[model samples]
Target: MSKKKKPSVLIYTDGACSGNPGPGGWAALLSWNGKEKEISGGEPDTTNNRMEMRAIIEALKALTRPCRVEIRSDSALIINAFKQNWVGSWIKRGWKKSNKKPVENQDLWKEMLKAMKPHDVTWTKVKGHADDERNNHVDGLAVEASKQYQ
Candidate 1:
């Protein structure tokens, strides 16, 4: 007998802020087997990058078991960080960047890393505020969340 395989999940995430370091929000949309779920939250005072990482972290935490996941985002900082091994390098160098500066969001980055440890995850870059319907939806969710904190 063979075990059944779980369907892969598709997730879209986005983050928004009233100012670079002002009230912010994060949103994630998870879909599997034609079922979709959306989650979002806001921070009274947070940076856009923190919200972005928070969105991904929260989405991965929603998974019940180890499985393949494809996450789409409009933040190149995230997609490029993983694709270019920026996170690995930072961990290897005391959470400092190439210039020896402390990583801006070490705490959030660490949380995201731990949340992603059990799954095979892929990151795809999507154009922000553009034609992609899913992206647009998630972006709208994030914007709404941001408004909640205002």
Candidate 2:
């Protein structure tokens, strides 16, 4: 038997925080089959990195079925974790970094991994606040969402 090919999806995400550990927001733009959907949410108290991870998690969760997903984000923390296999290392080390410190945002990281199980996911690092129209759009959405909590 052969497996059915999953639908392809492109997601661009961004996160913003009014103050570190203060109000924060995350946004994602999902594109599939010539259609696009934007989703965003905010937290009264959260870190920027948490919001970044949240954006990814929420986007993946929104998919009704498994897909071939490409996620673009400006966050090095999120990008490097997968590209550099930092998440794998941390998991092997019992969720601790090289310096023996507990990984920050472990909760979200775990949630993201679980949400990713149903799909084939790829990551792309996009230049933030630059000329990338999609990236800028998500950034603006995230910033505006953050302001709501202010």
Candidate 3:
């Protein structure tokens, strides 16, 4: 018998920080079928990159089942990590970078990898604070969520 295809999901994510290591927030907009869901959270002390990774991890965790997911974000760090196989290299090197230094946000990277295992994920890079309405909306949500900790 032919296997059934997984549901296709589109997710938009963004992260904001009031002061780099200060209050930070992450937001994600997930769309599937005719329904859409928005999720967001904040941290009292976090970096923008951590928040960015958090957005992706949380979005994937929100999925009830395995899916074909397309994630759009303005974070080149997140996108390039997968596109360039940096995560694989890091893992092979005992979580160390090419410079022989420890990778930053290694914890979240592990979480993200776990969250992604159940799905076929595609990463798309978008221009932040640009003309994309969805990107802008998610950015606003992230910024607002960060303000909650202020």
Candidate 4:
């Protein structure tokens, strides 16, 4: 008997920041046919949430065509914010937060939403620094991106 394999997907993600508003980075993986690839990037000064959002956005941007993707992040803010449909509501309301203030990362959120429009996306939360393989890969990539970032 032979085991079946899951379909290809852009996968698990994570991002990190040295400080609330400091060096930050994001990471992701592309998996298919028993192969996997990792990618990441960062900015010198940014927020943790921004990196989290950037991780997913950059992963989607890497795809040449719309495809199914499963994104796992350690960011409850990102996960809950997205899963609860808050982002859509925010977009509809001109990117305002519940306090009627402008969203912190409206630019990235808008870009992320647009990038995801053509794909089937599923988001999950994983405890950071846990043993999750893909999650760890992305975390590593994010950290590396931050360190190597210009």
User: Against the hidden reference, what TM-scores do the models get?
Assistant: 0.96, 0.98, 0.98, 0.87
List the lowest-lDDT window of 10 residues for candidate 3.
141-150
lDDT of 4 by residue, 1-78 (tens): 985433448578888888788999888887866878788889999988899888888888888776777877889988
List the candidates ranked by TM-score, beginning with the highest. Answer: 3, 2, 1, 4
RMSD (CA, angstroms), candidate 3: 0.6
Better of 3 and 4 by TM-score: 3
Cα displacement (Å) at residue 52, model 2: 0.5
Q: Please report how far candidate 2 places residue 37 from its true position, in Å.
A: 0.2
Off by over 4 Å in 4: 1-10
- What C-alpha lDDT does candidate 3 achieve relative to the native structure? 0.97
Candidate achieving higher TM-score, 1 or 2: 2
C-alpha root-mean-square deviation, each candidate: 1.1, 0.8, 0.6, 4.4
Against the true structure, whose TM-score is highest?
Answer: 3
Candidates in order have lDDT scores of 0.94, 0.97, 0.97, 0.83
**Candidate 1: residue 10 lDDT (0-100):** 96
- Candidate 2 Cα lDDT to native: 0.97
Give the per-residue lDDT digits (tens) of candidate 2, residues 36-146: 999999999998999999999999999999999999999999999999999999999999999999999899999999999999999999999999999999999999999
Return the clash pairs for model 2, or none. Answer: none
Better model by TM-score, 1 or 4?
1
lDDT of 3 by residue, 8-30 (tens): 99999999999989999999999
TM-score result, candidate 4 = 0.87
